[model samples]
Target chain A: MWLLKLAWKNMWRNRNRTAITIAAVFFSVILSILTNSLQDGIFDNLIKNVVSFYNGYIQVHKQGYWDEQILDNTFEGTSALEDSILALENVNALAPRLESFALASSDTLTKGCLVIGISPEKENSITELKNKLKEGEYLNEQDFGALIAEGLAKRLKLYLHDTLVIIGQGYHGAMAVGKYPIKGILKFGSPDLNDQMLYLSLPAAQELYGAPKMLTSYVVGLENPSNLDPTAEILRDKLGNEYEAMTWEEMMPEVVQHIRTDKGSLVIIQGVLYMLIGFGIIGTLLMMMVERKYEMGMLVAIGMKKRKLMQLMLIESVFTVLSGCILGMLASIPIVFYLNRYPIKFKGELAEVYEEFGFEAIFPTSTNPEIFLTQGLFVICMALLLSLYPIVKIARLDPVAAMKK
Target chain B: MNTVIDAHQVSKTFNPTTIPILAVNNVHLHLERGEFTALVGPSGSGKTTLLNLLGGLDKPDKGSIFINGVDITKLSPNALIDFRLNNIGFVFQSFNLIPVLTARENVELIMQLQHKDRREINERVETLFREIGLEDKLDTRPAQLSGGQQQRVAVARALASKPQFVLADEPTANLDSKSATNLLDIMAKLNQEENITFIFSTHDVRVIERARRVITLVDGQIHSDTAKVSTEVPHTAQKRTP
Candidate 1:
């Protein structure tokens, strides 16, 4: 108890020095927490944009269809299968799509494009497709009119209510051709998707393709996208071998790889930051040891063992660092909360670059408790590791020579 | 007379490779219980080095040092620290009390290091502070206390563990005449009344004049050893009640 008191008093002997050391630790912790929080928040937002905006958290397709993607490989969209999946917990909505590549032609331009068929109401519930309409109106179940993307309309020089022809190969080597008026023009954040996509009602597409009651894949939405893995497992088990269920992470491994690579680079940056923080703490410790050389010698010469002295120094350092960590955490809470609520909007080139990748150009901080706690613990461990300097120095101190100094 | 400390042909050298300085030559000495002795010499004559050797603060290059029959030079570094904590006390010329601690806390530190019971530590600190005329300044830190007061606190801290002897290295070197005299009086009284042994290394005539025995060093060897004849009662003959 008295040793604690002594350590406390000693730490305050040079108030300015102690305060500066503590401030260094405090600010470093805040920077580290904020950096990690912002990075996590941005990645999470990216996932929501790329996956949940339309791709769905998980998808079910015919076993050979994913590899071949031909109309002959399509399966029947059975009510029993839909009901079984919907009955399982966490399955929010499902949209069945019949997709194929075809030639889209207008007055002067003929473009190779992707043709998609959807049930308007079911697709609306899952992907909120109706809200993406930039011109005219959303599709109805019986309507044979097509929904063309804004980029594709601009390339074709077509207007709303313009006639367009879609030509493609149908199932079993049948020739597929269709003529429909453009009912709507939809906008998309990604230029790749916007320049090539076309949507039609399910029955209209089945008639044109000459294959009734057929679907390429069922896109399944979930209550939480993070729960995709376990939900996909349950769905796969119920569906048996005819179909394969895959999460977005598996279906879009490129996106997952990009996030992983970025996180790896971030780890290296954080390691450098930690090294700077460690060296700052070590510098202060070295100064402190030099200043208290005589006092340490006197204590030892008066029969205080070196181990006891080492213990006292260790206690003092821990107290200082823990105090700094707690203060840093307290100071960061409000800043992080405010930043999360009102994210920083980016403009100019960066905004355009983000739009190109189909992400919102805003910076948001995460409010995860783990970010604060794990970062705080990491900085504290660094402080403890730097304390080894004093321990080794004291253990090897020559008391008689120190007293003379 | 019981020998409290025995030094057998002790020697110490400094900068042995370049300008080899023999700090303490081969010398033999013995101290009895309850004796107030002083080692006096000119500058660079190795009085302080000899004191360090006898107090176990420095090791001898050539011979063994025994305190109460245990050869301290043979003990490990950790064991030597334990030995010093229980058997030897130290007082420095600059009054080296830890500046961050209060006078009472400084005195209690040694006893605490000894792992003494709380009640015993409190009792001993109280008595020693009072005995050294520092009871009024018990809570004062060294920085807040005068030089004389700091030295008194140092003395009290040294004796708090009730060691076999106290080694004071020029304790009065930094005090004014009045403060030095007062400090000497306190130390002299403690020796006479409590039968505590004190060995000091000093160039101060005031301190040497008050010593019952003086050992003078010249060129790292004892030049003369003399004892003063007392006209009054031998102070140690009078029994003290604690």
Candidate 2:
């Protein structure tokens, strides 16, 4: 233990060298923490927007309906489907929705849109579509009321009280048309959705589309988002071939794939950055060893054993790494916390690019505390691993050659 | 008398890139317990090489080397390290005290490797530091002390281990005239009072005059062995004797 203290003191003998080495480690640690925390936060926000807006962790639809999603491919005669699924242990909320496209017209203007029919209470419960109303009330449960996207409302020159005409093909081979007063102008984040989606009462939708008793797929919710697979399986067995239980996974396959690829690439990037940091530390340690070679030889000449010399080298490395790592970790906390609270915003072209793809432009680092702990551990551990090369080199050092220099 | 160090025809060769040179050729020497022996030779006469062979830091190419009756030449590298740690102390021309360690910690370094209790190491180091008249310099690092003080710390370190022999190679080469004399006097006194054998290789006249016995080497061989008759000391009351 005393020998180790001597080794630690030896490293600090060259003050500027020790400080430079520590600074390198400290900067690397800070960069790693920032990059990782931001990556985690961005990925999480994308997932939350997709899941909370429409797909409720998992979704349930008829088999093959996921791929086709046409009105004719929905669950037709699964009368016991809802009751059977609700019996599951973790099933929280489920809402059946009918989705289709139509051309909306306001006398002089015409635009294509995705028109959706939903049970007012159930849709309200799942997506809080009711709270998304910017200008008017939610679609009335007992009466015919419709929610139109802000972009769609603009093109049609439709106000909250203005009537708009929607035309499309019904469940069968017949034309469906309807004129309804716009109850609300809803903004559902993504500009694409803001330009295309319209929500109407389920009964009004069935009457207009000529699919009276027929409906569309269900959007299911679970107690915990992580338990999506198990809940989806039970629903699949109960509904059989008449329906398929599709989780958020199938709905947002591209999003999930993006997250996986992003994580893999970030790991490689952080790994390379840390490798560079390790090399910097190794360079410093090697320099220290070279400078102290004669002194080390003298120590052994004055009765220090090779084993004790090796211990001293290791102790020096540990001290250097620990000081930097602890300082770096301490410094990261407030910076990450402040960034998490107040996100970064991009305007103009960058904003438009994200909006075009149905994403938020402003990014916030995740508030998850694991971001700090996990990154801190990774940086500290890599630094320690880098320390090994110096110790090994010292252990194999020849005291005689050391003294000659 | 018990022989503290014994070597028979010890030869050391350094394998350079293109040629192997024999540094210490066919040399044999022994130091009895409590005796001060000087192995004197000019530079490149292989005095330090022979010292290394005796200290087990380097191996003889073609001969057996023993310390306190044990054939250290046959020991493995790790065993040789343990051997040196337990049975031998070294003082170098440069003093070789660790620059980062205080005077007492420098003395305690070997005993630390021996894994002695902290209390025992402290007491022994303290005793040795006091004997060297550096009790106030116990907390001073080698770099902080003068050349003479550094040598005194080295002597204390050598004595702290209580080894059977100390191998000193030009120990006072870096000190001033007074420091060299004072250090030699302490070492001579310690050799007499403690009965610890000290073997040195030097070109210094003061060391030669103070040494009880001297062995001269040249061209990789011992050229002469002589006993000195000191003109300075009174023979009647030699309180400390080897």
Cα distance off (Å), candidate 2, residue B45: 0.4
Candidate 1 C-alpha lDDT tens digits along B11-53: 9999989999999998888899999998877889999899888
Candidate 2 TM-score to native: 0.91
Docking class of 2: medium
Error of 2 at B66 (Å): 1.4
Score each candidate by Cα lDDT. 0.87, 0.79
Show how many residue pairs clash in every candidate, following the order shown.
0, 0
Off by over 4 Å in 1: A79-95, A100-211, A220-241, B229-242
> Which candidate number has the best TM-score?
2
Winning candidate number (lDDT)? 1
TM-score of chain B of 2: 0.91
